[model samples]
Target chain A: MSTIVKVGMADLKVVEYPDALTTLGLGSCVGICLYDSTTRVTGMAHIMLPSSKAIRKNENVAKFADTAITELIQIMESKGAKKTRFIAKIAGGAQMFAFSSQNDSMKIGERNAEAVRAILKELNIPIKADDTGGNFGRTIEFYSESGKLLIKTAGKGIKEI
Target chain B: MGIEFDRMNNDIIIDVLREIGNIGAGNAATSLAKMIDKKIDMKVPVVKLVDFDEVPEMLGGPENIVCGIFFKLEGDITGSIMFVLDQKSAINLVDLLMPRDNAEFDEFTISALKEIGNILSGSYIASLSGLTNLQIKISVPALAIDMAGAILSVPAIHFGQMSDNVLIIQNEFIEVLEAKSVDGYFFLIPDLDSYEVLLGSLGVTL
Candidate 1:
């Protein structure tokens, strides 16, 4: 039986081939899955906020886009995964409620998606596929062997990338 | 992050907070019971300071599909409030309130749910205000039917930014005749700076 590592909100994990990493209940949070197919190494992050700089508390690298992406890359590289060979598949970042005025905090889903995209661009990781921006929540599982991201929503079944 | 229950060793303070939950939830339950004319039984409310990861499990699980009604709390304390109901409870509530032949969460059903949310939240806040003497304003409620995790993330990110622990007040509603139970959670995620105001208004020493 393959071991499945569970990543919680504001957390991240890295796994090798034949193993999987999963995160549950991503609302406005974005789940970034990076895979280096050459080494069959996968890293997934469940990021809660767009940027760590805005938070005054001690930084949780796994909780923010800017820092979480950086930490995921470092961990993957340490585990024999080449940064240049890394490709990304992202999901979640949903606007779960409708509001009359779209304030900065209220648009966090869009902001999180944008931040992830920008950070991936800076890191030169090409995004292979993405399913984002809706009024729903998602639970995601990333398979390291095939580098497939399974995105599960409530009514909308499952989609693989 | 769980509540610092160890540090909060004062029984009087804990009792005061629990009383707040009792009054607020009691008013909401009474209004809900009056709306449907069905005897609604409510368990003693539970007040907790919980971590974000454990929140979805409170309703069921991260993947459990639920109907969440969300609104921002303004005035004395800035935060968010949500009323979460499962699909069965939502449909049953619509049946009781609207008494319609078809209960498919059509436009009418959705509207009825929102109205119920509005009434419940209004009564909840009103009771708190009456006890604390602090004016609380509630924004128009928005309803979403999806995974519990998705619906709750909005408030967690909005008001729970400063601390990992969130103060949650939860209660259950049950049907008297059928003995059917529906879990309803009331989350009042106050801003980080509002705790002092809340405790001070309640005459609890910080």
Candidate 2:
């Protein structure tokens, strides 16, 4: 039986085949899913911030995109998954609110998306699909069986990537 | 955990924080009363420091749809404030002023909700700064109608930069005319150092 494992905000998990990983209600936060189709091993990270450099109290490595991605990769590799064989699907990172007077924090969604992309490129992991940077929140479920990532929205229809 | 809790667990500090909530939310309820032309009573609910995971649960759940209005706090303090209402309460509150027939919130109802949040929250901040004699200003309020978890993520991420735990102060308003009530929440988050300033101004040591 396939079970969906829930990932909380600033948390991540890796699953074996037939198991799935899910994270709920990602607003400006980004959910990054990495998968290996051959082994059907998958991992998901719900990142709240773009980087971890600014935070002194950041003991949770899953809280930042730059740190979370690397940690997720290592954990997946430890479970017999190859980093070179991994592909990524990403969602969330929406500008939830629009203000005329823009500030650095207001553009966090875009920065998170950009940071994830840069990190993935630096690590040489190709992105298969991405749904980021809009005025919406998302809940994502990633299945290890088929490397399918399902993205659900409040008003928008469900989509698979 | 050690240092943050040390500052919060002090009896005098807790009493002082509760006093701030009383005065701040009281003024907010009064402003809400004037806007709706009804008798409003303030109900102080949960006021404490909570972990990030527990925050959305306080709003019913992560997936519960809510209308949240956010303002960035500046000047003597740095942080953000959010005014949240469940979908039903938002519709009911707007109906009191604009009297909409449709159940769904359109542009007019949405704008009205934002204005209400702006004014109501303005009073809360004014009272806080007035009490502490701190120079506090707020940015233009931003409104979002989305899942409680999604809308709350803005504040969580902003405050989460410091620690996983942040202070939460909730308020409930009762309308005496129809014996009906509306549930509104006020989240007051001050930056780490600013908390020291706030308490110091109020004659407390951190």
* Clash count, one per candidate: 1, 0
Tens-digit lDDT track of model 1 for B64-159: 888999888789987667888888788887776767676686788788989999999889988988999988889999999888888878766754
Tens-place lDDT digits, model 1, residues A9-124: 88899999899999988899999999999999899999888887867753568878988999999999999999999999999889988788776657889899999999999989
Candidate 2 CA-lDDT value: 0.84
The DockQ of each candidate is 0.63, 0.65
Shift of residue B205 alpha carbon in model 1, Å: 5.6
Encode model 2's per-residue lDDT on A1-161: one tens digit a residue.
Answer: 99999998889999998999998888999999999998888999999898899777678899999889999999999999999899999998898888787778778889989999999999999999999989888888999988888988889989998
Alpha-carbon TM-score of each model against the true structure: 0.88, 0.91
Off by over 4 Å in 1: A1-3, B1-17, B98-107
